[model samples]
Target chain A: MIYEEVLSGHQQELRRGTVVMAALATLETPGYGYGLLAVLEKSGLSVDANTLYPLLRRLEKQGLLDAEWDTTESRPRKMYKTSQSGRSLLDSLTAEWNYLATSLNALRSEEPNTPLKELP
Target chain B: MSSLSSRYVTAVSRSVPESQREDVEAEVAAAIADLREARLDAGTPPEDVERAVLLELGDPMRLAADYSNKPLHLIGPDYFPTYIRLLKILAATVLPVVAFAVMLGKLLSGGDAGEIASGGIIAGLGVAMHMFFWVTLIFALIERNPGSKEAKPKWDPTTLPDTPPGGVRLGDTIAAILVALVAVAYLPWQHFNSPFTDAQGQSMPTLNTELWPFWIPLLMLGLLATAVLEFIRYRAGGWSWRFVAINAILELLVAVPVVWLAATDSLFEPRFIGRLVTEGWLDASLHLNVTIIIITIGVVIWNLIDPLRKVRRDTAMRAKRVGSLG
Candidate 1:
């Protein structure tokens, strides 16, 4: 259980940065908070509503996300989309991510060789 | 809007900034409605969905913190170190001095040993609490004020002072200031009434009343100087030659008058001493004058050596850093 907790913590830390990138990328198409959560989950990036809602508001405040309230349906929904600046930020972040992945792969390949044993 | 949804919106809006309240409330309300609608479309019970949605959003206060960018802590990590440092300084310096003064006052008033001990403890705790309350309140204000600049400036590794090993903390200096203030304020007040009296009904003051006009003002001035010096030392974060010089001057301002008063046998009323001696309450052979003078000189010498030692330690650290770089 402790090992799982530690693993989960490390996983959360790793996913935190990726979640931001993924959110910005997915929000290129306009979506409400709940709708966006579904899209993110379907894409294998599960985030809590409490976390997602605040992130959306912070992104809007930073001028990286645009939001509009649509009252056309029975229930009003606040739809969010990536701003032009958000798209630009997404591109730069993607480039940086690629560079990091490539460097990490290179370092992994340089590790000392180990013999693999067949499972009994 | 449903009752739960409206309640959540109200709770969040109450904690948020006034300007952002309406917008935040509207956004939260819309989010809740969307969640409810989605659940209803999927055939989930309306009652179950409403409770689930609010639960998923977690505490309204925490949500409000994220929206308003206000920290949940009283003093944020940024200012916590400095706050604690100042607190320690007060606890070390001011607490002991206040305790000593109260103990002395009780003793001179002919209070029993237990009463003196308890009185000292109460006074020390009271002053320490006041120091803690005010310091925390100030730091909390700084943390909450969005317009307030950062307490510490941007860091540059090369320019940063080397952390002296077991260095004299900023708290010690602040404690000194607090102690001085207590002493300056308490001495005059305690002197106003005689705690002792002779069988002939003559009142005997703690200090000679004649020393009031010349001694009190000079002592206060010296204390005020120490306060100013401590304030500067706190801001600088470490010792320098300049701090040492100012500290020496202030120590002299305080120590000279004290030594002079003791040497001239003007610290305590001679009549009071004589009466106590006559009553066999005090030893006739006791050299009260010489004892006080020695104590005053001892404190002065100690104060002078403390800053000089810190200065030397700082200098040595800097030289080591330079030597390594070279």
Candidate 2:
């Protein structure tokens, strides 16, 4: 049980950074909250519906995502897509992530016996 | 369209801003409907899907918090340190001084020891509650209104001044100790051979001589503690939790006896007051005891306010430095 809790915590920390990247990548194509959730799940990032909805709203509010209500559908849906600035931010973040990943890989190769320090 | 979905939307809308309530309600409702449609397409029963979709959305209040983008905390991390520092200053200084005043007032008015103590405690607590309520309310308002001018400035290490070698200067501490020593030594002597004398050639001491045995020793102990605190402050160079704790203890030690003396009406020499009142040297109706108590309370308040003001000045200066750098 303890090991499971620790593993879940580590998984959460790992997913935290990817969630933003995943959201930006997926929202390049306009999608509503539920549809975006499905997309994220298919992409192996299973975010809670409540979490995704708010995150989408926050991103839109921050001008990183553009949102529009598609009333042509039977049920009106607030569809979201990545904004121009959001695309630029995504590019920068991607570059940073790649650099960080490479550095981590180099470190791991150098010290195979050293374990990552646990967060308090 | 489901009752459960409607209820959930209503709960969320209630907690959001009045201007955005309608928009939020419509958006949340649409999201729920979309989830229900997906479930129905997967062959789930309508009633089960409705319940499941609402449950998956989680708590409405938490959803509202995210929607608002405002802190749920009474005091956010930004202003929390300032809040704590202000609280300590009030607790150490304002509380004891107010308590002392109330006790003094009760004593002059002929209140018994128990009555005086209780009154002082009640008054102290009242002031503390008042301080806490207003402080929390202001901080909460600042938290809710994020872009307000009262918001904490961006922190920078360069903004911090080099900490002085000691918080309390050696000269100041020595001067205070000397003054305290004089006052302590003079109290007993003054009790017996007061500068003021009656027509009958008997010395009319200001304070009741009967209280000397208990009062003088207590006063000496308090002064000694104060001297030690000053030394500690001089050595430490800045306010720490330990320094604040010791300061509070010393304040209480000093305040209790002074308060007790005043409350029990044992501060003034009755004979001296009576002689003066009879000889027309003093006004018969003048509330000398009450006036003395008021002066003591005023002095305590002034002392307390002075240090707090300096701390505030220092904080403002640092904030100004950071602002300039930005």
Candidate 3:
């Protein structure tokens, strides 16, 4: 019973930071909350609305995402677009992601009997 | 916004700071409406969408917490390990030492058993509570304060302890030999030119003069044996089972008899006790024999266990290295 919980916990942890990276990258183009969620979900990156909304505000607070009220629609919505810093952050995060992917692949390909050191 | 969405947004916004309150409420209301609209457009009935959207958003209090950036945990992962490590250190070290001192002070000052127990236990618990409370408070504060992160010393692998291979440290052996030699010299010197004086002004050794014939010399021999054993340990560079056995025997040879003699009130000159009492140093009726015996027993137990523990550790370390090499 606990094993399932443990596995899911690990999977959630693995996806946690990637959610942030995904939001930052996708919001480079201006998008409303629902649109952003749908984009993320369609890309197989499901995020909780509660998590994403606060995270968007936090990113804006950190001067990463610029928020604007769009009253053009029948219902007013907050549109978010990544700021210059957010773009740079996304770039660095993408680079880090690639590096990690390569490292993980290298590690996975190694035989079990191989010396246990130097993941980095 | 629907009533449920309005309530959820209200709940989340109330806890947010006023500067951002109206903005967050508006954003949440818009998001909920969008969610409801999208689901309704996808052919879900309008009645179910509001509650579903609110449920999908999760608890409003958690959303508020996320916005406020205050961690829900008192001690998070960053500081938890350090907090626990320091707590264990305080428990193992400061708590016992302070408690022991409090108890000893109460004992020496002649408290009743209840008073001693209360004084020591209460003081110990108070210290432990303060250690925990303050350290936790400090870590919690540090966790919240962003600047304190940089203030912490950066950990480096070089700081790891690198112990030498041999079990018998040269300094320890030398110190042990010196202690034995000093006791050997001091015993005879004290016997000859005694420090304490009886009522007649004749020098009286603090130790019973009667002990000089058999017990004192035997104790001296034990000390000499310890010195020889220490020297052998130093030369051998590690403890074998044989060495540990002999070390235990040498330790018990001195400690057991001394503890027995002290317990029987034969170790000290009776006159010396009376003199101390007259000087108002010790309570006249108090029994010091138990204290001496306990301390001696504790020391002997420590002495016997220490070498054996070290030897076991050294053997394990050696075996690990050999296995790894093979």
Interface RMSD of each candidate, angstroms, one decimal: 1.1, 0.9, 0.8
Q: Candidate 1 lDDT, tens digit per residue, A30-53? A: 888888888888989999888888
**Model 1 Cα lDDT, one tens digit per residue, B150-228:** 4453445685557546435767876888998888786777676666786688666767778778787888888888887
- In model 1, state the lDDT of residue B132: 89
Deviating ranges (above 4 Å) for candidate 3:
A18-50, A59-66, A70-120, B1-162, B281-287, B312-326
The CA-based lDDT of model 1 is what?
Answer: 0.82
Model 2: lDDT of residue A82? 98
Q: Candidate 2, after superposition: displacement of residue A19 in Å? A: 1.7
Count of clashing pairs, candidate 2: 2
What TM-score quantifies how close candidate 1 is to the native fold? 0.60
Clashing pairs in 2: B107-B263, B167-B237
Q: CA shift at B182, candidate 1, in angstroms?
A: 34
lDDT of each: 0.82, 0.79, 0.85
lDDT of 2: 0.79
The CAPRI classification for model 2 reads as medium
- When 1 and 2 are scored with lDDT, the better candidate is 1
Instruction: Give one digit per residue, the lDDT tens place, for model 2 in A28-86.
Output: 98888898888888877899888888888888888999999898977688989999998
Per-prediction DockQ: 0.56, 0.66, 0.69
What's model 2's lDDT at B254? 68
